[model samples]
Structures are given as structure tokens and as C-alpha cells.
Target: MNKKIEKCAILMVSTDLTQKQIAEELNVSVQTIINWKKKDEFIEFKDDYQRKYLNNLAAKAIRTMDKLLTSDSDQVRYNAAKDILDRTGYKPTEKQNINMSGSLANPYEALTTEQLLKLAGDDDG
Candidate 1:
């Protein structure tokens, strides 16, 4: 196609601009920009590929953290991770789950919060 359009694709992938933003700047319709994206042509830039990969990894790490964060016990953590992986298409490496659980000093922190508060009693006296 046009060299201008090829350059536009590279620019769109390299920047954080939305389709509307790029379209407005390039004086093209948003639909045209979106069509470019759907063909994966716009995402061919090195920065764009890296950004997408990093975002995916961050998302998966966050999901694993979320699964590990809410547990009150080892069994609970195991169950939660299993459920989360099942729902999110995360593959559970045996070591990955075990490592996640190992990172917690106390998974029962939530249960202790109220007990600590009760021990402190009311300071509003």
C-alpha cells in the first residue's frame, strides 16, 4: 500500500495513543486504524510487541498474587490457585504454586486483624 500508511502503522504501535487519537492526528477514520490493528499489522513494532508481552506477564503475575493473597491456610491457597488457574487459563506448575505459598509469612493475616483489634479494645474511650 502507501508508504504513509505503513509509517502510520509503525507509529500507532510504538505510541500509547488510542485509535481515535492516532486517527485524529493522521486525519484518518478511526475505523481505518482499527482495521489495521485487527490485521495485527499495527502491532509489528518492536516496542509494541514488548509492551504487549510485558502487559501479559504483569497480568498473569497479578492473577497469581491474587490467588495467593487471600488464603487463610495452605489448603485454601492451593484451592484458590487451582480455581484461579482453571478460570484464567493459567498453567499451574507444581513449583509455582508452592513458591507462591512460600512467599507468605502468614496467610492468616486477615483472621488475625480482628483478634488484634479486640485485644487492643476501644481507644475512643
Candidate 2:
């Protein structure tokens, strides 16, 4: 609760160091780090695994967007949607259920998150 403790907690989160790493550096137990999180005062940093996953999702989204911009094919459209889903870490939200009579290449139509996820080569199973 001291200013020094608060500063340390902020520094730990900003540096991408996990709770264990910060604890080791500060000569404290991991439980202390967890306690900070539970109290909503601060939390652990982004571990390598989380960073890698975010990077992968960003790359996938970029590639898919490029494909959509270059090609007007139905497949390309599907790919764009898929990329968005992959980057977002959630299913796409559809506002309507009716299918319109436009080329599937169009991105402004209604498509299920499942369709986009499939196109992006992601596995939900």
C-alpha cells in the first residue's frame, strides 16, 4: 500500500514480467502478486505465451485483410471475416438473419461467426 509498492506493481505490469518473475525480483511470494490482482490494485504482466498469441492473431488478421482487398471472390470475402474473428478472440455478431442477393464477395452482408472462423482456418472444436 506504500508508494514504493505501488510503483513496483506498476513497473512489473508494464514490463511484461509475470507474477512469478516479479515476485522473484522483489523477494516476495507469488501469492502476494496474486493478492494484488484480487484486490484490483494491480495484476501480473503479459507472459510470452500471451504475447505470442496476440502477435499470431494480428498477423493472421493482416494477411486476411490483404486478401480481401486484392480479390473480390467469395473465398476472399470469407477470409476477411475469418481474419476479424481470429484477431478479436470472439465470434462475429450478426445483426440479421436474412441472406441478401449480392455477391458473396461483398463484406457488408450477414454471415455467421462460424463461417468466418472456418474461412480464417481457425478451429473452434
Candidate 3:
């Protein structure tokens, strides 16, 4: 791969710059950058670079978790703990698991005619 394409891949992941901005910064045409992106090597390089960057960031955040949790500011501690928990897959929303076997008959179909009609807001009584 050319050095410029390598540099472009790094810039694409490490910065929030648009393709036009990157082209201007690198002194290359926007089409050149778009062309490089279509290459398999460029795609692989960008994905690997971004994954490594995020892994490093996560490691750094984990290292600072203790300090953040013990910070003097209540909001800081709360936010830090919440961030850690969220990253660790803790969700505040309710989760319901419904088991669906091959058979269609289940709890939902057990309702009586009146019960189903009432639920549908069609009950006249």
C-alpha cells in the first residue's frame, strides 16, 4: 500500500474529519480517498485501527474507574459508576423473555371469547 493511503486510513478512524476535509489536509482529490476506501486493504486497515483504538480507550477508562468512583463530586461518581455499569452490559430497562415452541397454542390463546372481546374494546355489556 502507498504511504498516503495508509495515512488516509489512519486519519479516517482517528479523526472526525470528512472525506473532503481529509483530502484537503492530505492534498489529494476526494475521489482518491473514496477510491482507496473501496480497496480491501484499506477496509481491513481501517477496521483494525478502529478496533485497537477503542480497546485502548476502554482499557484507559477501566483504569480510571476507581478514581472516578471515589471522586469528591457526587455527580462525577454517579456518572462514572453508571458509565462503568453500562459498558459492562447493565441495562435499566425491563426485559421480558417469551418462549415460543413449535406449537402455536399458549397462554395468549387461552382467553375466553368475552375476555378477548373486552380486550379488543368490542364488549357491549
Q: Pick the candidate with the highest lDDT.
A: 3
lDDT, candidate 2, 1-125, per-residue tens: 55535655555645788777777877778887676656533433334434655676877867768768567688877777777777678776755544366424456346687777777888672
TM-score of each: 0.31, 0.31, 0.61
After best superposition, candidate 3 residue 103: deviation in angstroms?
32
| Model 1 per-residue lDDT tens digits across residues 1-125 | 45546656656656788768878888889888767666644456535656776787888877766867586788878877777667788876544223355673543465666666666785443
Error of 3 at 1 (Å): 1.3
RMSD (Cα, Å) for all candidates, in order, is: 15.1, 15.2, 10.3
- The true-versus-predicted C-alpha distance at residue 38 of model 3, in Å, is 1.7
lDDT of 3 at 8: 93
Clash count, one per candidate: 0, 0, 0
lDDT of 2: 0.63
Candidate 2 TM-score, true structure as reference: 0.31
Q: Candidate 3: worst 10 consecutive residues by lDDT?
A: 96-105
Report the Cα lDDT for candidate 1.
0.67
| Model 3 accuracy (lDDT, Cα) | 0.87
2 or 3, which is superior by TM-score? 3
| lDDT values, one for every candidate | 0.67, 0.63, 0.87
